[model samples]
Target: MVPAAVLALASLLPVQSSAAQNHAQPDQPAKALARSILQQLIEINTTDSAGSVSATSKAMEQRLLDGGFAKEDIFLGGPTDRKQNLVVRYRGTGQKKPVLFLCHEDVVEARREDWTTDPFRLIEKDGYFYGRGTQDMKDNDAILVTAFLLLKKEGYRPDRDLILALTADEEGGSSNGVDWLLKTHRSLIGDPAFVINPDGGGVDLQNGRAISVDMDATEKLYADFQLRTTNPGGHSSLPVPDNAIYHLADALERLQHYTFPAELNAVTRAYFEKLSTIEHGQRAEDIRAILKPSPDALAIARLSAVSPEWNSILHTTCVATRLLAGHANNALPQTAQANVNCRILPGHSREETRQALIRIVADAAVSVRYVDDAGNVHDTAPESKGFPPPPLTPEVIAPLEKLAATMWPGAPVIPTMATGASDSVYTEALGMPSYGISGIALETNDVRAHGKDERLPVSSYYRGLQFYYEYVKMLSGGQ
Candidate 1:
């Protein structure tokens, strides 16, 4: 027998009738519009060093205006002349609060030399869309823009408002668009029923087969630390044992050999448990062994060695991302510095990680300092843990399940945490429940968001486009 409270909660959520379950997927016009928007966005450089995200925002705002949205409903503003954010709202019947669809327009810096094709140009060859933001997500930006336009064309009003926010500097910068908006213009974004972010979460595919539809229920904390050592310079012919470069290099070598202890929270523990059921043979056994109270050392080592994804899930990871030294070749370096980037697990604090790094380095000569987003260096960091993950309410999960059943029949929807991070950090920080759910599917081996030759399969892009349209309709109680 079900409890009375459980039944009451179930009755509050809107149920999808058989008639409401189906809708036209991405038709020809929708595909063309999405493709055009994506190409335009790609060709316009939004990189941190040289690109103008402010211009990109204005261009999108014009598109919305041309599509019949009033000039008053669209907003464009940010901290600076080059970095701007766009917020557009679609009116509704006022039955519920708005749903915020947050996507960042800025992408990681891409160079022409690093990729086979120009990273700035949208090239479709061999069944894939090759571009910088194709995978790390201009695709979702285009998808959401197209969905709103199509809805307006159909004259379909929903039970609640739908808001889309395209912003700057999610990849890397001081003036984060989401942070600026929340601080300066919370009234525009307004209160939301919830936030659906497409910056993370994806369909996991292995060997071209659907493994699971993963949702980023939570994410690791991002922190960067600077390691520095200084000493008196000397001529290359007169070398000394006490050298800055040697000290810094030795500390980094120790860091390379060491790994953080295995730590798992509620989300990751459940992730491994669900993953064990899908994975088979020796791999499955290793996962099960690691879940034990005293997990086997060999199993942890073997699994962590083979997959970086599993390694990140199981432990806090820190690696040296940038290094600088040697002002002159003829003289000993007076100073040396390196940037150690870390993704800390949820329970640990940034300060705690810094303290651990100091211990691992075991050298007083090499000083560790915390580096903030603004490039400010400090000796200490905050003791607070990462944002607590919100409960997976039925209202959020039900629609996802219903849609996934029709699209990928055998795939299970699994809740997992992001190994890296996204702009969801800004919204979730405000106590607004944010979830990362994108319909795009990519192969596990071909995962290359920030790497060379970043591409999304042509079929996958269109399918994801269709999925977001149907998904928003299902969430908003639209026909």
Candidate 2:
């Protein structure tokens, strides 16, 4: 669905860019600049537990300053001194409204003992860059920074103003950067036509070959439920079947076995429609059958059996993530609790999912309650669904399609829903559509973000650098 406006914007002439630097070729300095920026960011600890996000924000601010951006165009502020967000405006000819680009500065906590190499240090070995944020993000941060600097240095003018926001607390915390900026510094990032987020979607590769260039159109809502039961304690030797542990365990088992009904929205349907064209044989047949007025039950079963992703896309998933039961090994558990995390499909509220879980457990003794990020327990969950997805306008989709075809020849661009969540939740709630457009490619099996030995392919980082360079230009009306 290419917007008619995109085709018309190309005919406009390029005026003198506001903050043009020294004349330099776009391609020559991009690779080196990207690597340096990524290395600096990776080594800096921006984790919520033992790092300062504002440190990285300042470092990045220095990079833009050196690239000749006016100091007035850049602003740094957040909820706290330790967690600051960086927002920079790349001035254009003002032919159109601004476009906001968002990425987070925080990475999940990584321990040295868990990773083979230092998680904070960028170690390039065996064709990969191993670091905490390599896959989860920082790589895209480098890509975006490099693109802005390169474009600025090359004097490339755009038709619309471009806003770049590298913020903090996206991983998890009370001081969320996106929510804060939109609340406190509204003018810093004015209402953009739409947003481009590098947090979720990109090229999905299998066995070193590109499979699908996924554009995350929407994502599932994230919610956590606390399942608990309490009973009178007894000695281990006198354990009873009606104990707290048994009741809680039984409830969790029921939830594990129960599957939510199959659901699909326009984005997911379009995802499979485009994917079916790229697949072959029985896999292809199964995908096509799922699109019929009455999707074949056998087809859903087959696809769900082979791919966890397809299964998640077809259904809302809730699983026990953590459990705490019993005070000591020698005593019967007096209280037992398990945490159930659910990724609800769009069009469903948190309260609706909580009610569904209560029904699935079907035990009056076991209580289901919503848990907030700050660990507060509530009697009920929110009755609101995730912000509705906006239309897939042409101005956004067309440029990515054109660039993706050129970069990854066979990888077709398909709009897929993110099974997980990102900070785009805040902006999307404001009615500005956000599309996940990370040009970084990753193998299906090698995704290690927030886990041990998180890494990104060596070549993938460089390709991402080029992707944003051309992509930002194309969408902003650059020649």
Candidate 3:
């Protein structure tokens, strides 16, 4: 399913000359290769409509093959045709278990009309790379590929094999890339010591300077519940108190007033402990108070109400996203439905969240039920419970902390819990400790991962390249 234009572009890519390959300083060549790969990926329109992940995977597959990788070490298949994943292994001496590098090839849909320039085209302007996946990812994918190829060229042997999985549909669609790979091709990844995912972690910056390298060791659980109310249809003039839309509205109002209790885990505790040092005044005081064995109730309420992000990190959150009611303009609706999305904390059960919703609504006419990933409605609880947050073991954090000091100098490496979800959830669920360390730095106010005009600073992109290059080398025992 590779697009003809992408393949044509791939065929036209300039080959690295012998002189450039032989140069003692390989940083230039590696950066060029990374840029080339990133541009090609961005231009392919890998959205669900105009582009194919299979195409992107094949393009990267060809790059590795051209760099002298054996065909057998590279895998290009997924559950579906257009949604194929690419897994490449760079074999080592087998002194240790393999290390996995994961990045999704799929991106959120972007329309040409919504962007200042073409979303599918990589435009370098104002010292930034403007595109949909530039900041969300694709930058990490390019860096990983470039590093692998450069290391191969250098003949740097590792104590363990390094596996790279460029996957599809991590941005909300059918057939998640990581889920499919885990269920179908677990052996390809093998039982690695842990996984390095660049999807969740990032360097938080202020005024173009890094404050800290945030490593997300855990993520909130994503679950959806459908709130529905049914009533007999009636004429507009004969509206009754038992209207479905009104019942649903009242339930949602009650939910808006409800808030989950504040709690803290190891990751959040560390996050606040570090964050408190940088903040001042009441905000800093509130952060420190929350870290106490018994947090101040007033401080928790003040902090939670002041910021939605703080609220999400402190407690599970459920909010109505989509609503549907009347079939006709002039008729009382026979049914009303609302989709309530919840980001539950680790160890929380889907059943527990659903039951809480039922209690909050407290309406016999309003029924709450779980909605499966495929949009199927089910009255029963999920068969599987939410996975607990992974422990921040020394094996993962030590190298990260050491490298963060070397790379950014004085920027504290903070353990974080992602309010958003990532493919790491699937790997962690399979008992493989997964950590999100995208190795890219982003200003806190400048994140546009799924939004329009998404971009990454030109300098930050290269910094990420160097960061991951060394980090991967150290972890893989090439240093």
**Predicted model with the maximum lDDT:** 1
Per-residue lDDT over 1-479 for candidate 2, one digit per residue giving the tens place of the 0 to 100 score? 11110111222213323222111223545777888999999999999888999999999999999999999999998889889999999999988889999999999999899889999999999999999899889999988998899899989989999999999988887788999999999988887999999997887665555656778899999999999999889889997889998889889989989989887789888877866765667988998999988999889889877777788888899999899988999998889999999999999999999999999999998999999766789999989897667789999999999887767755667787888989898999888999988888787666788889999998888878878888898888854
The reply for model 1, stretches above 4 Å from the true place, is: 1-25
**Candidate 3: tens digits of C-alpha lDDT, residues 14-69:** 44344422323336777788899999988877776556899999999999999989
If ranked by TM-score, best first, what sequence of candidates would result?
Answer: 1, 2, 3
Residue 283, candidate 3: Cα error in Å is 3.0
The candidate, 1 or 2, that scores higher on TM-score is: 1
Ranking the candidates on lDDT from highest down gives 1, 2, 3
Cα-based lDDT at residue 361, candidate 3: 100
Q: 326-381, model 1: which lDDT tens digit per residue?
A: 79999999999999999999888999999999999999999999998888999998
Model 3 alpha-carbon drift over 4 Å, by segment: 1-26, 49-51
**Model 1 lDDT, residue 204, Cα:** 64
* Model 2 regions lying over 4 Å from their true place: 1-28, 277-282
